[model samples]
Target: MRNDFSNYFNNSSENKWYNSSYIGVSLSIPVFDGLQKRSKSRQAKLEYTRTGLILDNTKERFNVDFKNAINNYYNNKTNVERQNQNINLAEKVYVETALKYREGLASMSDLLQDEMGLSNAQASYLNALYNFKEAEINIMSLNGEIKYLINK
Candidate 1:
């Protein structure tokens, strides 16, 4: 509803007071401007595609990392086994060298070298064992990634 009213300030012979009434109905229909709705729709589609791509890339990376971790775990485990075998072989050689040295068939230097080789084998075994443990830890980290993905 709307209203308008007025009174004449100067006197006139026509009339001193006036009254009027009016009633009207109006309708306003909105129209799109500048293709804003289409632009917004395209933007929403692009955003959805971008978000899906990001998730795909993240999942791909996780798969690669998980596979690599498992491979490294197995490889390090094999290395540890090889190193353990080396330790055993070195021990046997050192014992033989010691027996020869006692019976005068091997020199003290030979026995000492064999002992050092055994010690080095033990050190290598320890290093390989450490690598295996590290690989295990890396494999375990995949669990955390799984939890994150699940929550997300």
Candidate 2:
């Protein structure tokens, strides 16, 4: 409804015109409330599905890393054990050669050669020990079981 009271005035008094005022009744109409809910639910479900997939992948990666760490631990243990055996055999040979030399059955050169072989074997053993320790540390770290001597 629009009303202008200035129209009731005479021409001379109506020189100032009053603006028409309007009162309106309005209603907000939703075009598709049901469709909006369906779309939002679908979008949420898709996001949830994506998050699940990402979590699954993360879990799989963790499992694979754990398995790899276990494999490395076993392999390192085997290597160290083999190296220790070789070192023991080399030590036995060195001792036998030294004894043979003392008894005048083997030359000094043979003793020295055995000594060198034993030294090389000891080096290999030490290297294997270090590798084993490193692998153990890696496995501990992977399993989240590493404890620091000095905690900060």
- The TM-score values for the models, in the order shown, are 0.75, 0.69
Candidate 1 C-alpha lDDT tens digits along 1-152: 12222333344456655688899999986675789888999999999999999999999999999999999999999999999999999999999999999999999999999999999999999999999999887886786754665688
Candidate 1 accuracy as lDDT: 0.90
The alpha-carbon lDDT assigned to residue 66 of candidate 2 equals 85
Q: Output candidate 2 Cα RMSD.
A: 5.8
What is candidate 1's CA lDDT for residue 150?
A: 61
What lDDT would each prediction earn against the true structure? 0.90, 0.87
How close to the true structure is residue 82 of candidate 2, measured as C-alpha lDDT? 95
Question: RMSD of each candidate?
Answer: 7.5, 5.8
Clashes of each: 0, 0
Q: Which stretches of candidate 2 lie over 4 Å from their true place?
A: 1-29, 33-37, 147-152
